[model samples]
Target chain A: MLSINDIHVQVDDKPILNGITLTVNPGEVHAIMGPNGSGKSTLSNVLAGRPGYQVTAGSIRYQGQDLLTMKPEERARAGLFLAFQYPVEIPGVSNIYLLKAALNALRKSRGQTEVDAMDFLALVKSKIKTVNLDESFLYRGINEGFSGGEKKRNEILQMAILEPLLCILDETDSGLDIDALKQVADGVNALRTPERSFILVTHYQRLLDYVQPDQVHVLAGGRIVRTGGPELALELEAKGYGWIEHLPRETGP
Target chain B: MNHSLTLDTRLHDRIPHLPGHRLDWMNQFRQERLAAFTTTDPGGKQDKQWHLSAAAAADATDPPHLDPAWLERYRLPDVFSLVWVDGVFCPHYCVREGLPAGVCLKSLDELSDAELTELRPDLTQPGLQEADALMNWNLAWLQSGAFLRIPERVHLEKPVQLLCITTAPVGLVSLRHVIRLGRNSRATLIHTQTGQAGASGTTGETTAIWLEQAAVLAHYSLQTQPATARHFARLDVATDTGACFHQHHLALGAARALTDIQIRAADQVSCELNGLFYADGNRQTAIYTRVQQAGSQGITRETYRGIATDKAHGVFEGLLQLQPGVRKITATLQNRNLLLSPQAQIDSRPQLEINAEDVQCSHGVTVGQLDEDAVFFLVSRGLSEAEARTLLSFAFANEIIGKIPLTACRDQARQAFLAALPQADIHQDWL
Candidate 1:
């Protein structure tokens, strides 16, 4: 199981993740839905150990190990992957290199041999067919000048390649269209396993139809204010966070 | 400082020994090198280390020499080689055969009296004050010359290698070379001068070379001298109408190496120049380059890359001049430098002089360390800091090194670059 225990996180001197606690067992997907300014993205970033997010007080445990103690890469090596909200455009470094380097780093951590050029190319070709990305993107600098949808799809491609145990996807469906969203969802679904868990951070219930999370949580004022089964996403999508805003301030954060 | 820099005495001695023409223009040129040498205040330009006599004083160590025994290890495979070792030509070797018909490749000693006469006067053309000093200094100490002349429309299959081997026995070792590729001719020369393997604390080496008319030449000069060796070389090229010229100067090592490369194009000519300078340890290297468009419709692009660490200092000064009436000229110059250590310093200057409004010219210069965001991104992606920085630096140099047409030279540049990085410092934080 992956769990965040009363995490208190701040960014640039402002509190964002205010003592928020959430959990997900193996084979369970939890959708974190929130209003625009309610710190939905902050929760995802804090969980992934993104730089600049100060975790003042919190204990995040994954598979019974202290998650916060690990460096971002070490956490990643320990099977924690975060699909970033804004994928950086790295010029002159081909996507092929990024994928291979990431895979080999993880392989090294696992006490396995690194993939050679030929085998790595073969692996990427097979995965490329799934995302429907052209071979040219493989040669282009990583995410450099890629379209918004293409960038999001690239994140999904990285998720597919690394295959982490606990995946925290931050707003992965924001810029994705119906077709791209479906492809991305299909790719994520293809990697579903009883030993893996996912924490999907999205503001809409639209993606939940394809991803089908086991639980849904509402984060308001940097705290989880509401929790329910998968149907909570549809209810919140239909009614919106306006109803929650009218609730008592003492209820969260 | 006000003394006229005259090379008359040096030219008088060299002209009689050189093989060139007896034209009146030749005499004018001989007088010019002398006048420029005598009249110009070569010492007043106290800017970068181009002042030959200035650098010698600042450096306390004995300058480089021409130790033949030490030069044996620095030889390039399967190419004709020549050198003015310690200002003296030693064990000279030249291939007079298998050259393309109308092709001429020989040392200054091997040159016939007639051919030597033709190159003598232009060797010190007018407006070449500092240039004349460079040639005069070489003439004063010249032991031999590796001269290559390609006749009109001749194209050679293999490149010619000119190796100037220098060792630090006395003070400074200076040299000169003239590679003239004729009308519609195409050739490439890999001119490399290395320090004698086992030398004193440090040494300085200066060399000057030129290429002329409708000649398609790819001039490559590389220096991997020790961090204790100081090298200074000025490469000045004046191309004729419709000539195409390209040069790649690489200085990965050299305790102190100051290189200046200037390419002036005749009307309708084009040139592409690129350089890579890297220094580790306390090594210091400086580069100054200018591309002057003389004729109309000329084009040029200049790029310089430097990666420095461990108190290493690098300086890059570039000038792109599009003279009046040289309309429709397109020029671009860029100098990008990277500093690895906190003490590593780089002073880069990229300039543009456009007298013609119709010309399209632009220049840019940047001196910075590896991008922090890029470094963190690579590290977060599980790359060691050393691996990440080296990869980034190599990527910065790829555009320049990738263009090297020769397979072997390009490979050497990449290998040397990767090997110059610090291994101990990168893994410090990994644990």
Candidate 2:
């Protein structure tokens, strides 16, 4: 479903990801593990077509199309979602309003009619339940004055509502307590389908404990140092990334 | 009759024909104000704080017939309303049904000589009198307006709406409004000024409000004129001890518009000022507010938001003055602005002059473009860049628009504000 070949990314003339290569089949959940400033978030952002992240070298293909050639909104309409590590608080824009606008935009891009108001509200109400948020939250400004855990849950709520094809959770596990972590993991697991793919970029293994990944990749010095089965996460958690810090980088698939 | 003549000169020639001209005190008042306006420079120079030049008032002409549907668009249901067409009060369109007893509402021309004489002190109160040239000019040409008064201890349930519509093609519309609330009385007043598309002239409005002890007054002013029109409005408010005053002003239209609001608060009085101004497509909108805490233990809060797009210009100047010996006063002022285009410009100045001890005062002003991160966040949700920006800009202005206390008025202001935004065609459900 997605291919990253020798991707080298730079932000503001500073290289963040160097010669990275990876591939994911449909329905595969890949856990990208790294230390601080190790470029895990950069890869997620690059995949989502965020601006200011220059793909200096290499190519990315999503659904057999050039992902780099698409605008952020274009990528979004094509079913690429990125749950931000630190979601921004947009005052005066209600959560439900944004959700409706986003869903309608995606539907319009696919030449579908707009969602019925009653149906949309019902969908939102059901989806919000999975994230453990009150109905009042949908009326308030987007994440305005929300607690840290609530903000993260709101991201999941949006994800559940939009139902993207390729989801990238950028540090979504951070700042979330154990309860919130489980709720988010359940939300993600419920949305997983045989045709959907997920890239979970995280710094900790706790989230993995809740949502099992198909593969685990340890990244260091802007390159993937090792790739293995889900057991790699347990190993990394035990040894704490230090044992693999000096490993040689993988060439490619 | 020369349209090119200076405003003062025109007023000088027309003073004899203006209403109340035969009364000696009224004549003296108009002459003195005209002199004051003439001596004060029409400020557009570099040294002046004003950023826009006042448009010359077009010669008065017979107002055009307005469609009922058009009039209904600006009317609020179940309220005592007065309609003004091209600076002239149209009694036929006035709605005064169910007006409570002990309430007085009348057109300035309808006021008897005795009423005018009794209100002379309030008309010329030194605190309400500023050296502003446009305000002086408004006083000099004041012929049409509404005067509303609520008697002591009487809480008026129905709001009073003063609707002014301009339909004279390139004609001047000048109005003056006076509101006085007696002790412990409460009232809501909505003042809306709008001009038809074909009407492109200058409008001058001045409102002087008096709130007696423990009275509560909620005043809203919504100005949405045509793109080619010029609007200048001034609000002078004075409150007695323990009174509460809430003022919401929305400047959403006009090619060049400036609103000046001045307030003086008495002991333990509370005052709140909320304002939003949007300028687009070479239009210029400005709001200047000065609030003075004249008595001890008063409270004042001011919040203003401005949006300028596509070579438009917006200006906000707020001044808070805490008089000496006014202890335990709390005053805060916040002004936030957004520039939607590279060529758009916004000027925000918040000044505080405190001469009292034991007072808490803070002021903050922010001028910035839409938050790029927030824009990306929205765009990443499948909305196009234009839609994202429009939504964000609407959100920015909604911070102030959401504070309008009256639902009907707020809805009207919100719709007007949304329509003024660039790419306002975004689905209404998203707002």
- Could you say which candidate leads in lDDT? 2
What lDDT is reached at residue A11 by model 1?
88
Worst 10 residues of 1 chain A by lDDT: A244-253
- Binned by DockQ into CAPRI classes (incorrect, acceptable, medium, high), candidate 1 is acceptable
Which ranges of candidate 2 are over 4 A from the true structure?
B1-17, B44-55
Model 2, span B118-152: residue lDDT tens: 87876665344454777766777786798999999
- The TM-score between candidate 1 and the true structure equals 0.83
Top-DockQ candidate index: 2
What DockQ does each candidate score versus the true complex, computed on alpha carbons? 0.28, 0.83
**Total backbone collisions for each predicted model:** 27, 0
| lDDT at residue B100 of model 2 (Cα atoms) | 82
